[model samples]
Target: MPFIVTDACIQCKYTDCVSVCPMDCFVEGPNFVVIDPEGCIDCSVCVPQCPVDAIVNAAEVSPQQAEFVELNARLARAPGWRPLTQAKAPMDGHEQWAGVAGKRAHLRLTW
Candidate 1:
């Protein structure tokens, strides 16, 4: 299963995980990051590097955050979302709300 980035990564899109990803499956989101299921090799290399503990294997994602697996895959295919390896400094600041509930509001999927 592919890994997914969770709400904890919002506004703190640390690129450390991006730097460690061997398959370049990670993709830059507006405020966080996502993994391309089609590209990820399940190497688990990017998980430990996340400063906010946002990365998780698709099947292991917490029930509250399980939607992220689909979100990540969908965003990965969306037009204009750039692959992580192709970006020079992909992680950029975006509006983030504290204590946002639900998967959609908490995770910054768009700029």
Candidate 2:
């Protein structure tokens, strides 16, 4: 299964995973990064790069995070989402939001 970026990534927008991704599958949104399922090679290289432990194998996704399987794909195709290939600064106040949960509601679909 492909790796999926869960809601744990909602506001943090950490790009560490992006730099390690061989396929450059990650696409950035306003405040989050998602793996493009189509481009993801299921190599798991990006898994350890996520500080929030947001990246998970699709088969391992918990029920609460099940939506992210489709969410990542959808967001990767969103109008403003663009390839994220390098590690960069996280979103403003990322430290405060890093440990926060239930952040799916905070995801910004538009740039």
Candidate 3:
């Protein structure tokens, strides 16, 4: 039961979860970080570290967020994504987007 990074993480790109993940399984994208399903150990350590509570065990996701389960998998397997093992500041003025919805429309999939 690997965890999934959902919409709350869309534009925030918070690195708190990355810093604590024992497996270093997170992959960084333009405005998000995804958990590589194959590398994740279903550990809950990264859950609480997410400031917006965006990380949820795959089995526990709501219907609206169910897409993220597959999203994380696909993006984790995508090329050009960087591995994030250290914590960093959130995107500039991240506070404005921390909990915004409908952010998927703004997701930068190519970079």
Error of 1 at 36 (Å): 0.4
C-alpha RMSD in Å of predicted model 1 compared with the true structure: 3.3
Alpha-carbon TM-score of each model against the true structure? 0.80, 0.97, 0.96
TM-score rank order: 2, 3, 1
- Error (Å) of candidate 2 at residue 3 is 0.4
lDDT of 1 by residue, 68-102 (tens): 88888898887777888743442444224323434
Candidate maximizing TM-score: 2
Instruction: Give the Å shift of residue 70 in candidate 1.
Output: 0.4
lDDT of 3 at 94: 85
List the candidates ranked by lDDT, beginning with the highest.
Answer: 2, 3, 1
Error of 3 at 94 (Å): 0.7
Tens-place lDDT per residue, model 3, 1-111, is: 999899888889998999999999999999888999999999799999998999999999999999999999999988898888999999986899986886777778877
> What residue runs in model 2 are displaced by over 4 Å at the alpha carbon?
none
Go through the candidates in order and give each one's C-alpha lDDT: 0.74, 0.91, 0.90
